[model samples]
Target chain A: MSEAPAVRLVEVHKAYRRGAQRVPVLAGITFDIAAGEFLALMGPSGSGKSTLLNLIAGIDQADSGDVIVAGENLARLPERLLADWRATHVGFIFQFYNLMPVLTAYENVQLPLLLTDLPRRERRAHVEHALSLVGLADRMSHYPNELSGGQQQRVAIARALITDPPLIVADEPTGDLDRESAADVLHMMQALNRELGKTIIMVTHDQRAADHAHSIMRLDKGVLWSNPDDAAAVQPAGQG
Target chain B: MRAVPLAYSLRNLWTRRLTTVLTAGGMALVVFVFAAVLMLDQGLKDTLVATGAVDNAVLIRRGSGTEIQSGIERAQIGIVEAQPQVALGAGGTALASREVVVLIGLAKRGAPDSVANVVVRGVGAVGLSLRPQLRITEGREFRPGSDEIIVAHNIRRRFEGADLGQTLSFGGRSWRIVGLFDAGGSGFDSEVWGDADQFMQAFRRNGYSALVVKLNDPEAFDAFLLGIESDPRLTVEAKREPVFYADQSQAMSTFLTVLGLALSIIFSVGAVIGAMITMYAAVAARVGEIGTLRALGFRAGGVLLAFLLESLLLSLVGAAVGLAAASLLQTYTVSTMNFQSFSELAFGFRLTTAIVLKTLAFSLVMGLAGGLLPALRAARMNIVEALRAA
Candidate 1:
């Protein structure tokens, strides 16, 4: 049996009022994401894909319409409640691998656990498990500066999974990685989606990385273009 | 919804080890100077204020500002003690003694003509019983009819022939220093004590510098002063012993207060500037990290609080350093001319816990004020811009 939808954006609109000009980024966009689904959003720069991801993660608010994620109406929530919702239900992985420079990889993984009611022993267990899953358990004590770009991104992914959030939003997670490291990272994401049955919504510009997702959707000029046949024909390379 | 503890702030401070140490050092220097001035003022005031005799009343000539300038006829000592409010000793004798004061020149070791002035007073036989805290640490008390003298402990090492068994020439007469005594570190420590009759004859002081009269009861001080003022025959003014000492310290006390305030103001400005520079750098360096925290469900308020705490910790370091440096000044001595006595007086610096605490509090205030603008700027930053910042 399939679970309910994890995220839904209904007729959502986002606009910026720049010196008397109303520039709408997302005009009446709508979508639904089922639980345990692997969906990829591919688009060029400034195509509103990242903005749509931010709205679903509750990191940004829409100008109008409903943004329901993890069963709550995110658009109707207050700022403080939205922050709490994001802390508990949504995990974010950014393109820059924004791990705190002062904290070690283990401490970076433990960041989201600080917002939980888990005991120290339990939090440590979760952090260790997440790092092992990303295959960085040996580098737990190393600071971000001591790690390479790919290693830093792995730490960021560990931080996201440590909280066990149902919906993970990754925005250009391999944008700064080399080709070999990027392929290794794509394999890890595919395994997380297929083996662990996690729900992931990734926004990227790379078609090769997009092929790993079960469904690939294109976004351009604030509109989504879906073609089921093209999405099925592309196969992701394993452990390349 | 992570609740930060004191450890969070402390750990953050430890993370920026270099910045923390430098800022704390600067604040410490400020507190040290501030504490030194306060302690010096307290020490000077304490030296004179602790010498009061609860049952004794001092008689100064009307309108005379200091004991050095106040004198009365030798015969009037009897009449002043005969007042009804006067206390008595054994054999029904009145509890009054005559005292004479003169400024003497002295020299410090390895220093030229330091030329500090001190009071040399003549006390009667009953004077020893009037002050119980006085103890002769060396030799014997001066003989009542002989040209011998006792020196206060503070004056013993401060001049030539001030110790016991030493002889000195004063007022054209040779006198022997027969004893050394300690008077609980009071105004009495600055004086030389001798036999009243012998002192009067040698100095040709047919008049006494002041009348030291013990009252029948301490509670009767106002009544005694009123009784003395009502009589035209006795042209003397009476005051409580503690009140008189405090009045004498007023000029120097005021000077020290102004000095302390001036130093604190100037040093606070420097401390505030130092704190501001450190906070600005901290905020500038942590742009993307701040954005991550903001995205991780922390409000702008939390980030602001964290930075402010960092600033406070830095300033506290400076305050601690300043206080420690100031504490070392406790062994230092300073000499200044007393406006009331018109003679140079030497006093030692003192550092107390209250002064240290006040300096630290001032440093914290400076830290808060200095860190405010930078912390607000960090809080007002756009999350997207901060994340995109290189």
Candidate 2:
């Protein structure tokens, strides 16, 4: 059985403007992500992995080509509409957890839901549910500074899932955690993909963290290469 | 996102307490100066507003701004009294009197070496009875027919030799001060009263300075004014007491308004600059945090609005502090040169609701102005670069 891709990038190109210089970051990259699939993107520094993730997540614009995430062409959307699309359809997890230092873990989980028209009682229930999903219901009132690195990452994951977006894009989710903590986070991500049927696209340099994904895609010098048959395979050419 | 903004910004400010305090202090000083200027304007206006009494009308020479320069002929007094608009006294005579106003210098009591200006008025025998509001708060009223004088409550406290039985030399005549009186905190509270005939004879003045006419009805001011001005025979101007007092305050009031606006603008600019610097520092310190927010799907406009709200919140705190301190100034009397009266007039700080509201509103504007550019800079930051910095 096969599932349709949740995200499809067709010959996408991204460039940066630095004092009249159009320095290219990603050039003619193409990729697809299936629904409920766990995908890992492996790349060296400056290989455009983060840029590609930003483009797919609708956080940044692509200079050219179609970025269809959940069947919506993000590149053609205006900033306001793009923001609305992101709010409803995408969830992002950062390497540092990025929890607001002033807010408790529960409030951090509640952040994305504030953009919705949910009633206060309903929003609270959603946040509580998200926190419980991360196994952090007891630490809901704890601030980011008061929590450990692994706990903070859990809170971030909870925040990413708060809006129940169809797609979750995690940028080095385990980059700042210890080995055991990283394994715990990897387990949580696997559970989210398997049990909740969430389609996740994660970027990580650690092979051990990438080992949990069902598929591995590699980008080299702005180009993407992927395996056709193996459950998890990295193309040697792109890896280099 | 709405809840995140306030939560994040407030926590950030709390984390950076030292910087926030310094920024608040700078804004507070600016607001203090702004509030003081407004109070000065209000104080000057209130001082003159208090001078008008309901039953009185001030008759001056046509085209003159003050009683000091006004000259009404002695012959016109009979015709003015004969006008049906004049109120009748107990003896069936018109209740009107001629008076002279002049500025005099007196040595201040506490600052004995410093000279200050005081208004000395010459009134008819019926003048004391005309102003029934006047009361001798200390010492006796001056003997009506003598060269003795009665000093206003405020004048006696500020100047030397102004208490009962003390002597004051004015226009080559030394008069004894036998009374200390008050006239309900009006401009009359800043003057000294003496017999008009004796005062004019000693000062070598042939004509009265102005006439104080008690009208039959307060609303008859226009008719009385027309009767006095439109007649070719009498070259005089007549106005209701309240209207005349308002005009008399014009110069000082204008000065205060100009000073208040100038000070508020100057201070607000400084406050805006301080707020800008503070917000810029905040943006710089939170580069990574802001990037995280962007990466979490917050649009640039949301980030910009959040910072602007933070700045406005800080400025409002400062504004509240400044306004509270300024309100305490109601009892603080300051000696200033009244341009219209050409005297060192004493007025207390006046805190009006309108001025307070305007000052706070200006502070809010300052916050928005100062926060806009820095917030824009923060919003425009590249997500990748910010993440890399983190």
Assess each model's interface with DockQ, reporting 2 decimals per model.
0.40, 0.55
Q: Is the docking of candidate 2 incorrect, acceptable, medium or high quality?
A: medium
lDDT of 1 by residue, B106-202 (tens): 6654464666776778887777777776788889888888899888877776765576787767777888988999877666777788887777777
Clashing pairs in 1: B24-B317, B24-B318, B27-B318, B27-B319, B28-B318, B28-B319, B28-B321, B28-B322, B29-B322, B32-B322
lDDT of 2 by residue, B81-180 (tens): 7787889888898887789888888899888889987888988767877777688887787776688999987887888888788889998989998888
What TM-score does each model's chain B reach against the true chain B?
0.91, 0.92
> Can you give the lDDT of residue A228 in candidate 2?
64
Cα lDDT, all candidates: 0.80, 0.83
Q: What CA RMSD would you report for each candidate?
A: 4.8, 2.7
lDDT of 2 by residue, A113-140 (tens): 8788999899999989888988999999
Candidate 2 — which residues are off by over 4 angstroms?
A: A1-3, A17-23, A227-231, A234-240, B1-4, B125-133
What's the lDDT for residue B271 in model 1?
79
